[model samples]
Structures are given as C-alpha cells and as structure tokens.
Target: MIDMLVNLYELPDSSELYQRLEEQGIILRRANAYERHIVADWVGAHFSPKWVSEVKVAFSRQPITCFIATREKEVLGFACIETTAKGFYGPTGVGEDARGTGIGKALLFRSMEALKDNGYVYGVIGGVGPREFYQKTIGAIEIPNSDPGIYRDILPD
Candidate 1:
C-alpha cells in the first residue's frame, strides 16, 4: 500500500455527487463529538481497530475531522481527515451493502474539502487501498518510494 498525493486546490466540484446522494436520501456531514463512540464502534465493526483509533483522534479535533454518510439515522460510510497526520485523508470506508451508492466518494470529497478549508494546498492519502480509484477521482499521484511510509513500524493488532 503506497501513499498518494492530491492537490487540494485542484479538487473537482463535488456538488453533483452530493446532490445525487441527497436524492437517494443520503446525508453527508461532519461527525459530531457526541457521536464519537458510535462512529468509532462502527468503524471497528466495519473496518479495523486501527481505524477506530484514528476515528477517535478525529473526534478530538475542535471541528471533528470526521465526516459520515448516513440515511434515516443509519450510518452508511465515513471518512476521516487529518487523523493520522496533518493534511492526511483516510481511514474511510463504506458498508458492504452501501458499496455502489456513491457514499464512499461523497465521504471522500467531504474530507478533502475540509482539508482544503483548513488551508492545505496538498493532501496525502496514506496507505492507499484503491489506488486506481484515487487516481481517477481526485487526480491523486503516487508518491515514489512511499510503500509502508508511516506504516513502516506499525504495531501489530
């Protein structure tokens, strides 16, 4: 898993994607402090304990760097920015059942936009899983020699 870089200033407009999600009754918004436990638990169940730890960190920020996709009170997906490090976007996942609903992309855009709002010129996508997806969606470029970057000395679960 290599890290990728994205130019935040060049992010594509996400309004159309957001509008489509809205029509499907999906709501995208920043996760509130009060929802930390719920979101953390969801990430643990749907992704990994490592990601749950990162989600907790996201909740600790003043503005809560986490964004969630929900529908009628059910969480469909989530994205966390600046959790592992400043200007980092990651730890995002969509439920298996919600995979094709555009929730993941919406959550991604929300996270990237937030990074931009925080004065970031470029953002890092750490330990990317879907390399092609990032490349096509946000024009993310591979960072040479970045495999295992910050994850080099990670402790085992």
Candidate 2:
C-alpha cells in the first residue's frame, strides 16, 4: 500500500459534513480523555491491534487527536490524526452496521480538517487503502515509491 498526500490548505469546509451526520443521529466529536479505553478497545476489536495502539497515543495527546462517530452514546466509528505517523490521517473505520450512511466520508474529511487547523500545510494519508475514495473525496495523490514508506519494519503477524 502506497502513501497518499492531501493538500490541507485546500480542504473543503467541515461544518457541512458535521451537520449532515448530525441529521442522521450521528454525533461527530473528538474523543474525550475519559473515553480512551472504551474507544481503543472498540477499535482493536473492530479493526487491528496496531490501530488500537496508535489510537491510545492519539488519546494521550493534548487536544485528543481522535474523532468518533456515535449514536445514542454508542461508538459507531472512529478516525485518528497524527497517529502512527506525524501529519498523517488514518486508522479509521465504521462498524459493519454503520456503513453506507456517509459516516466514513465525514470522518475522513473532518479528520483531515483537524490536521489543517493544527497548521499542517499538507497531510499524508499514510498507506492508503481506498485509492479512488481518497481521490474523489479530497484529490489525494499518490506519493510515488511510498509503499512501506513508514512501515518498512512492520513485523509479521
């Protein structure tokens, strides 16, 4: 998987995405310190152990680098920034039941927006999975020869 780059200075507005998710009973907000363990466990169970580890670091950071999609107090999905790698956006997912509601798109744009607000002129979607999604959503471009760019030492499972 190659890394992809996003132009933080040219990101689309985020408030509109927030409003759209809110209308669907989805509350999009930063994960609070008190919710760290719960969120990390959820991510681990639903995603990967590596992602869980990165998410823990995100929670420890001041301002909380993780964002979550919740409905009625239950975690529906999550996205994290500046975790696993600096100036990077990733490790995000929606529950199987939560798919097809635009939740993923909202998470992607909103998290990249947070990176922009934090003074990043450009953000790396490190080791991208959905190439067309990134391309259509934010015009993310391939970082040539970035395969295993930062995960050159990833240990075998």
Candidate 3:
C-alpha cells in the first residue's frame, strides 16, 4: 500500500496553509460554503454567490470536512470531504493545477488515515475525479455508481 504522508493542520493552522498557498499563487482555500466567489475562482467555474450560500447551509446539516493544499508556501489545492451516514469519503478534490504530482493520492490517503484514526474503517470517494486514480493509487474498489460514489475501506481484522 502507498501510504501518503500529510500534515494534518487544525482549523487555526489553516491560516498557515492559506499563507503558503498565497505565496504560490494558488488561490484555493477551505472556505465556508457561503464563500462562493472564492470557490468559483478556485475552480475556474462561473458560479453565483447564491450557490455558495445554499451549499453552506447544506454543509452544516451534513458531514463536511475541508482542507487546503500549499506548494512552496502557496495554495495549490483545496478539498471537501463529505462523509455519508455510513462513513464514506465524499466530494474530494485536488485543484485543477494541483492534479497529478501525487497530490490526489496524498490527499486521499491523508483523509482516509484520519478517518481510520477516528474509528471509521471504511471510506468512499463521491463525485470526484479520476476513477482509475482511486483504484490504482489506494487500491479502492469501484462499486456500481448505485450511490454514485467511489467506496473504499480499511476493514478491522
């Protein structure tokens, strides 16, 4: 197994990640759902603040985990991990520019490790990218998109 190492920064440490990200000119951040412009700009998508506002509210009701990635002291990527009631990794990302370079795998591994540490022995990647990456990089299984998510697990022996 390719266990990728990632430094888990608390919400406060997020500032450091943002600072580093700013230096690299990567404008990604773990903003609240109400912050749509920030996310739009980060994803290069034309979205309205209304979407951000709506999502923020939805996020509060659901299990949402967010994080930012920095390269050389600049924000390179941001991710949102929305967990299912059954404990799955959902809605993950490694910014467009930050794709490859093992960032996705690193992010996925870090998130899964964290989940595992928290007693979640399983995870799923939902509404994300590169299906092959999930399987090849972390040995995740590709279930039918019945739940429309990439479900993977580290079961307790």
Candidate 4:
C-alpha cells in the first residue's frame, strides 16, 4: 500500500505492446464521455465505488484521462491517469478473465504516455497494490512513508 513514482520521460516505448494487443483484438483508447455510465457501472460491480467515482471525474476532464481495453465492444480493462490527483496514475484494473494478455501493460503504458505528452516529468501511482508489476513495467519507485498518503482520511459511508 505504498505510493510509487514513475519517471514519465524515461518510460520505454509502448507501441510494440499496443500493436500486440491490437493484433489480439483488444482495442486500447481513451474512454469516451458518453460511455462514462457504462464504464462506471462496470467498475462499481467489479472494482470499487471509489474508482468508479474517480473514473467519472476523469471523463469530465476536457481531455479525457482514462483509457480502456476492449474487445468486440466489451470492456476488458481500464486505466485512468490524473484522476484522484494531478500527475497520478491509478485506478487501473483488468478483468479477472481477461488478464495475462498484456492488456494491463498496454493500458498502463498508454496512460503514462498521455501524461508524458501533457508535459508531466513524473507521475505518482498512489496507494499502489502491485508493486512489482509497476516496477517491472515502468520502473516505478516506492515513495517512503506514503501508505495512505492521500487516503488517510477516507471515511466509510
């Protein structure tokens, strides 16, 4: 549950991974504004309510900050950047049945590239779960004393 930092500029190119996903019929792209409700409902049922709320905010941004991997119109996975906080990469998840196809990596890299294009030198992955996955994928480094960094005051409804 530690926050991790990513050096956006240092990320390796993701085009190859993207192409692989494309070949497998998984399309990676920004989440459309009109698709927010469906995406949010999916997240709420599969992930968490907090993430669904944040994904809604991501859709509201002028330039949408959320990305998704879909196949034949079904949402396979999603990754959102700059949702909870500026320059923060998170709220990402892959469907249990749709994992191991490089979708998660594609989503992560795509979102990080977007942040880089937005001039972010570094991106924070707040309250991270898969530490090794982020580290192996994007060389993310742990931020000391960051457990519950921004979620310390989250109250139950």
What is the overall TM-score of model 3 with all chains considered together? 0.52
Query: How far in Å is the alpha carbon of 128 misplaced in model 2?
Result: 0.6
Candidate 1 colliding pairs, count: 0
The order by descending TM-score is 1, 4, 2, 3
Clashing pairs in 4: none
Backbone clashes for every candidate come to 0, 0, 6, 0
Query: Which parts of model 4 have CA positions greater than 4 angstroms off?
Result: none
lDDT of prediction 2 = 0.91
Give the number of the best model, judged by TM-score: 1
Query: Which residue pairs come into collision in candidate 2?
Result: none
Best lDDT goes to which candidate? 1
lDDT of 4 by residue, 5-112 (tens): 999879998889988998999999998999999899988889988898899989999898889999999999999998888999889999999999999999989988
Candidate 1: misplaced stretches above 4 Å? none
- Model 3 lDDT on a 0 to 1 scale: 0.46
Q: Cα deviation of 80 in candidate 4 (Å)? A: 0.8
Candidate 4 lDDT: 0.91
* Candidate 3 lDDT over residue span 1-157, tens digit each: 2211222232112345435535645544344555434544553442334323333432464233544455555445544444343344534445565665455554555556556655665665554456666665566665554443233552342
Error of 2 at 61 (Å): 0.5
Clashes by residue pair, model 1: none
Report the error of model 2 at residue 115, Å: 0.7
